[model samples]
Target chain A: EPEVTQTPSHQVTQMGQEVILRCVPISNHLYFYWYRQILGQKVEFLVSFYNNEISEKSEIFDDQFSVERPDGSNFTLKIRSTKLEDSAMYFCASSGQGVTYEQYFGPGTRLTVT
Target chain B: AQRVTQPEKLLSVFKGAPVELKCNYSYSGSPELFWYVQYSRQRLQLLLRHISRESIKGFTADLNKGETSFHLKKPFAQEEDSAMYYCALSGRGSARQLTFGSGTQLTVLP
Candidate 1:
């Protein structure tokens, strides 16, 4: 079965540096989402992207966070300035349409902001 | 606030044993519930949804709106069923955004 794929399975960065997590959603899927889980915490939603725009966002996704669909296949989450608390497992997911609620998630990228 | 809660952090059972993973949710209006599973070294994937009303891989979950619970159950636990199980909930007539539980780690010892 086709699945969402993410690059850089793990990322390490300085506290003040920027990091971009990349994801390639399944072809033919429309809705894309970003979620994260801090170690030992529940997975939290970050943002949802559709039609090249954001549909929803959580408080954790502040100004430092931005998502872009630079290409037909790539969806990226960019953090302008990382904080220690930013370390977490970032997951990318996609669904076929808005009517359907099922989402397929990628393996996730472990981000560590030291 | 929307929330999903899985009370058990870990559950261990022997092969052929019955297993139940409990999930509870707090949502005001109509709710949609789902169970997702993640095997070791595998991506999280949808196991089953309450709306489907169908069983998958011998696992089934029934949504109890009266009790705000959706518990996953399987009559016989197989080693392959050992994985991290997460319960999720979404509200009706709104965004499909999901609120997930902390998750339950199911281990079926051979």
Candidate 2:
């Protein structure tokens, strides 16, 4: 089965540096999303992207966070000035059209800011 | 606001025993519910959705709107069923962003 794929399974960055997490969602899917999970915490939604624009975002997805579909296959999330609290497992998901379709998740990228 | 609650942090059952994982949601509008499972060293994957109303791998879940719950159940559990299960909900829209619960780790002991 085709699955969502993410790059840089694990990343370590300085507190003030910028980090970009990349994901390649299923080719035919139209909707994409980004979620994060702090260690020992529930998964939290960050943002959703469709048609090269953001559909919705949470409070956690502030000005420091940005998402881009620079190409047809690549979706990337960039965090400027990463904070210690920003360390978490970031997951990317995609789903086909329909209200009942299930979203498929990627393996996730573990971001560690020190 | 939409929220999902999975009260049990951990649950264990012996092989061949029945299993149930509880989930509850709070949403003003009609919401979509789903169960996602992640095995050790594997990525999170969809197990079942309320809309399908079908069983997968001998497991089934009923969406109880009256109780505001969607509990996953299996009559006879197997060792392979051990994994982390999450209850999630999405509001009625195109965003399709999910709000997930803390999750329940189920261990099926042999």
Tell me the DockQ of each model, to 2 decimals.
0.73, 0.91
Q: Which pairs clash (backbone N, Cα, C closer than 3 Å) in model 1?
A: none
Indicate the residue-level lDDT of B32 in model 2.
Answer: 88
Off by over 4 Å in 2: none
Query: Please, what are the lDDT tens digits per residue for candidate 2 over residues B37-110?
Result: 99998999999999989899999999999999999999999999999999999898888889999999999999
TM-scores, all models, native as reference: 0.97, 0.98
lDDT of 1 by residue, B40-88 (tens): 9998889999989999999999999899999999999999999999999
lDDT of 2 at B89: 96
- Tens digit per residue, CA lDDT, model 2, A1-114: 899999999999999999999999999998999999999999999999999999999999999999999989999999999999999999999988875357899999999999
Q: Indicate the residue-level lDDT of B22 in model 1.
A: 100
**Whose TM-score is greatest here?**
2
Candidate number with greatest lDDT: 2
